[model samples]
Target: MDNSSSSNITSSPTELDLDNLRAIKVLGKGAMGTVFLAHHASTDPSALSPFALKVVDKSLSFAADADRRARWEISVLSRFRLHDPLHPFLPSLLGSSETADILCWAVPYCPGGDLNVLRHRQNDSVFSPAVIRFYLAEIILALEHLHGLGIVYRDLKPENILIQQSGHVTLTDFDLSRSLTPKKTVDPLPVCSDPETDFVPSRTFTRFVCPRKKKSVTNQKGLRKAKSARVSPVSRRNPGSFYERSNSFVGTEEYVSPEVVRGDGHEFSVDWWALGVLCYEMLYGKTPFRGKNRKDTFKRILMMQPEFMGKPNALTDLIGKLLEKDPTRRLGYRRGASEIKEHEFFRGLRWDLLTEVVRPPFLPSKDETELTEEVKKGGIDIREYFDKLKAPSSPLWSPSLDEQRHNVSLTEF
Candidate 1:
């Protein structure tokens, strides 16, 4: 019931219906719902523009929770004026609607897919320094806008960063975001456990290498295997203030911050930590601290330092500061995006003229839509898809707010 939409959609600009959409294919599926690449059925069958449609089933066993999250995302998007563009990197809610058993919304289809997909296609499954700089600037501006609106984007993995037709990035999947009132008061007191103490004991803290990298290291003894950091963990004492701290634990496993991992109340600094992880992955082709399992991954996040390959530079230095275990000490911890934008890595970059850049690292052509023969003649009825769910299906997985892992996990698009 909390749904509203913008009429600025480039394709229709009018309230569309399930009847008007021909689902070309499933774009991706997430914890709460599935997204489809759909075009207006009334348009030329091979129209250049098609939007992404997200469909959520509100009749499942977890409908109450699903509906609440779906509505929350809708409300958040309602804040952005899509047509005029409050921030270019952020997405606009093109249109939305819900029925007695189904809830749905539309956003502009991102033809370039997600950052994760794009990263895999690169030469080393990684980006160059210039490319990383360009993308990070846009993503940083997006986070800045969201934080300015008092919204904490709990989820910040590469999968949620989508590339628009214009080659600029737009963040998607807001169901995991939390609305907080920015409290300028002093740092929050830690509860339950000190994240600093969550570090693995020195002797047992085996070298936590990113599973993807083949890089190796050795100590003075010339031993290459099973080496771990003796470096002191960053102090947990936060120097910066924050919005009201949230006790709710939610986020992607690899990107979750030290505070959230330790059950300490968290605030906006969590996003900064994730930005660090994002940068590390962009430069090195892998997340810095991924381990065998979620628990191990989180342990590495709380304990180990990121291993910077090759000679360290401004970019690596920026990543190190951002990945500081102490959220208070992290880059952009207090003053937000300004702290990040001023980093040496972004030097000489015109923050205001990002949109005017004629060539992005990658440009998705208008004909990027690779419609199959089935897609060309294609038809899938959304209403019929949900209507067919009269019988019980598998319960959709939702992340536990208590920080416990369920048997199921699904990402949001």
Candidate 2:
């Protein structure tokens, strides 16, 4: 816990008093808690600005873990708020508070929505190379800053990459992230002088596209019915290590690294593996190593290589290097993000000037930035909202819905 960076944070009030805060709408609901579109109750309700408040209801069965994660996220955000000068791409803690039955923290709202939703809005449900490059560069810089602080962002996916009002990307969800102490180690692989000739292979690899299956009426109905009944996968407990390797099998199923799935110790390299999966998903429409279910997905992650659909290119080459099974041999393992920054795919990228870039791929509509008229009429107490939802007659706490709510996926929020 270093507080040296505390002096540098001046953009927003460092401490938010929950008594003055009001919830506008439910932004999302996840495993840890719910995120609400909130603002200071005294502030103009019609104002364009509002922040997101993540609240953990402590009366729930899993309140302890959720409380710990909420606090951890606050700590992580505090560090970024005090130390990181680049606020455009990282979340800053506007305020945080706790009560006997609740814990809550607020962050600047990202109106552009998460990358997953934005990608779905695209015509082909995928981004062009240029858009991917822009977004990836911002993400790389954010990861670089986190690594510099000795933190490992184990969760890196489209869902966590949020778009700012300026349309640039900002990463969210630090609950799954862990702080690690980096040990000095020698690079096992030598740096190549000629990146162009050293990395590119002569043979072009072709990937087969799996055909989409048509769903029968009964199958479609079953899927629709199952949507509300699906349960979240079991969460992995923290290994509670600081300087040494972490052995916890934590991460989303599709984006998890090979080492994580094998239950072998993991460090910062896991993020690079996830970056490869994200890049592949951005290029094509889905994850490369996905299988039928969780078991099959994990097995493929350990034994299968990422399948690419196009001919050999700098982007594909970068993906291949990042997806390397050996953590040490991975593209960013040794030098961290510096190695990936120098890759041929990002050869001409001006990493230093990333924040100055104007006109990002998409700008959020005005409706996203302002509270709806209907929402403006009501001022809901954050704690009372959850308490009411958990009451006996409430739909959220009903016997049948209790299991579903308890097992809700983390992505829903």
- Judging by lDDT against the true structure, name the best candidate: 2
Clashing pairs in 1: none
Per-candidate Cα lDDT values, in order, are 0.70, 0.72
**Model 1, stretches more than 4 Å misplaced?**
1-15, 43-46, 82-84, 185-240, 372-376, 387-413
Worst 10 residues of 1 by lDDT: 202-211
**Model 2: runs farther than 4 Å from truth?**
1-13, 185-243, 368-370, 392-413
Candidate 2 residue-wise lDDT at 243: 38
Model 2: how far residue 403 lies from native, Å: 14
TM-score per model over all chains: 0.77, 0.78
Clashing pairs in 2: none
Indicate the residue-level lDDT of 354 in model 2: 62
Worst 10 residues of 2 by lDDT: 202-211
Report the C-alpha lDDT of model 2 over 1-413, residue by residue, as the tens digit: 12222322233445567888888877777767888888886674654568898889899987877777777777788788667364577888887777788778888899888898899899899988878888888899889878777789888988889988888898998877877764544333333233232222211111111122332577436634543343223112222122357766677778888888777788888999999999999988799888887778878989988887768998999999999987756777646787787666765455555666666788887664336674557767877788788876875432321122122123333
